[model samples]
Target: MQSPFDEPGRIFSNKRPLEEDYTPDTILCRDEEIDRYSEALQDVIEGFGPNNVFIYGQTGNGKTVVTRVMMDHLQNETHKHDVDLTILEVNCNKHDSIFNVLLELVNQLRDPDDQVKDQGPTKGYLWNTLYDELDRLGGDVLVVLDEVDMLGHDNDKLLYDFPRARKNGDLENARIGVIGISNNHMFKDELDPRVKSTLCESEIFFSPYDATQLSEILDHYAGLVFKDSVLEDGVIPLCAAKAAQEQGDAREALDLLETAGNIARKENADTVTEDHVERASDRVEEQRVLTIVRDQLTSQMKLALLATTFLNIDESAEPRAKNIYQVYKNICKTCGYEPRSKRRLNDFLDSIRLYGLLERDERNLGRAGGRSYIHTLEVEPELVFEGLEYDSDGDDSVLNQAGIVPSPEDTDQYSLESFGA
Candidate 1:
């Protein structure tokens, strides 16, 4: 039976579980991690002993996903045995302060009416609320602190307080366990000895996916995301191979597949092939560079990138930072924003260099030509500017101010010349 393309709902097919769509039931290909997690969590159910486990890995390496899934499973299994188990998950990035974290937990425990906000004495009061809530609950509790390293290295009090609370006589009935998930391996190394002892009872590391694993993961996603007729046989493998070569990141492989699928659909193609993947890679790579540019840039730095982009769009102007700054100052005037001074602007350019948006170089002129430094944009200014969300202006405000006119007949390729020899 052949499917018709005219039908809107059936156009694209997918087999992979997207990050948003990922669930305990749907997660696949992480058996080793699952086994280790389940083993560490089983003690709580069996009443033998609960272990504090730390999970560490790079972004999108399934640390949170697996921990959440395993914890959910543990909770369910514990419930069947008439055991009272509470798992509270908190993202430390948002609930960073001790008071805030305890407030969240207290809110979770208390009825809405009992929860107080403005009745603050100090953070000491909030810790009391947390203790009272846990003590009132009177059962075993598991605290999953995601991105725990964000709590700052010195503030290991929460780490010490949660797991050791039972042993330290903070709570009589509630046996507490802490599972800390972090992206940084050095987090444990930097931890204070007391906090480190509590949080590092067991540690599991998730290694990045290799090319084979990425291929398998992408194959699952491609089958679920694209239409059966949309993807040719080799497309998934190619995308996977490229992503693995760059970074053994599963999410990156999935992004590549999704982006390629999007491009194919936009082109109204019946079948996605290698050509679509290649084209999609260019667009995705451009977007990746743009994201790097956008995140690391301040408003003034963005203006610099915008200026460089505008210059690159102009046929005559060389993509130099000094020239770009001349244009940037004009842009700041047009946008009604105060311009940063030249020294400050230089700092912004140095940051842009760190972000890989632009390159800095020194030109050593032979005795005939004296040495001077130069600047250039490494990427296409038009693309970079689009990423920065800057708009184009028609009036040559920059040219008028600099007393420079662009030559229409100029033909030169801009290269990011290296600085410091």
Candidate 2:
């Protein structure tokens, strides 16, 4: 008997290019963004100083990759001109607070053996240590904060202070600049006015890639990762079109293609075909929806979503805001939790809509003098049920108490009428 790991995979010649962290040497379909990013960093290469840059884009649109490419070019040019440059980077998702961010920066500056512990230090001490490190390095230093929005409104003091550190007497020798990259386009606006002005001296936005752009990018990566003629003619196009229709996310497209290849390899197929792509896409989308519903939403938001899902399954039509609110209140009561105000429930709906989990439409009332919003589940109702069920830890689910189960085949199992809707 031969083990599965005995032979090399036949589908993917190289899988590194499909990895999330992999950065290609050439970035296609982002020439304009690259040019803008280059201009933002040109000041650093010229020896004047680094400019604070703010970049905003949705996930998988190449914001981080473009920044890395630009930084590499900046380093080469600065070296040629003999300009002293130091670059520090951290993802604010892990180090979410001001103190943790400062600590991460301090640790990055220190030698591996001399790192400071996360505990037993005031934020002020950490700031001083960071300033001291900067002054010692004593050149132009660029601090790149990726997912900076994760710091939230309370922890944004670093954004305000980092750019102005030199002039504010925090450091006498080092000139500091900050580059904040966020997936939330509204994050910059939510910052304090003072922080916003200093950190956004230069701003760039990366738009989602259209189908044509995603196809080009997929072709480029396919050429690098797959053996010649291994991909069927329609595989790349199907993957690109599917991703474009959803979020125009290049990462999703790449994941789809990679999963398709893996599926083909598992089946001992010589070429990846459109059928594999379709199956891969379904799997990817289901996982994505589950992750968002389970991990990303708050308890109240989950209740609201559960309400919407129930209505969607029962009525087979989009539920209005009032209908959803009524159902949500009933579910909250069944679960022994207090319901939020109607206004707050609307906010939850909007937030869910922003996540692309729900689709909302406005119905204008010609003679009624007002409009009503209707919402439909953007994902399959069964996926929502599974997410909520897992979130509640299986059989003891709040959904179960509310008479909502994952049986889509029998819609008669539950109804809003039972909830007094």
Strongest candidate by lDDT: 2
Backbone clashes under 3 angstroms, per model:
18, 0
In model 2, the Cα lDDT at residue 378 comes to 91
Pairing residues by index, what is the TM-score of model 1? 0.68
**Model 2 TM-score, 2 decimals:** 0.75
* Candidate 2 residue spans exceeding 4 A from truth: 1-9, 290-421
**Model 1 agreement with the true structure over 168-285: per-residue lDDT tens digits:** 8778878888899876666777678878887998888988777888888777766677666677889888988888776466766777777887777767777778888888888777
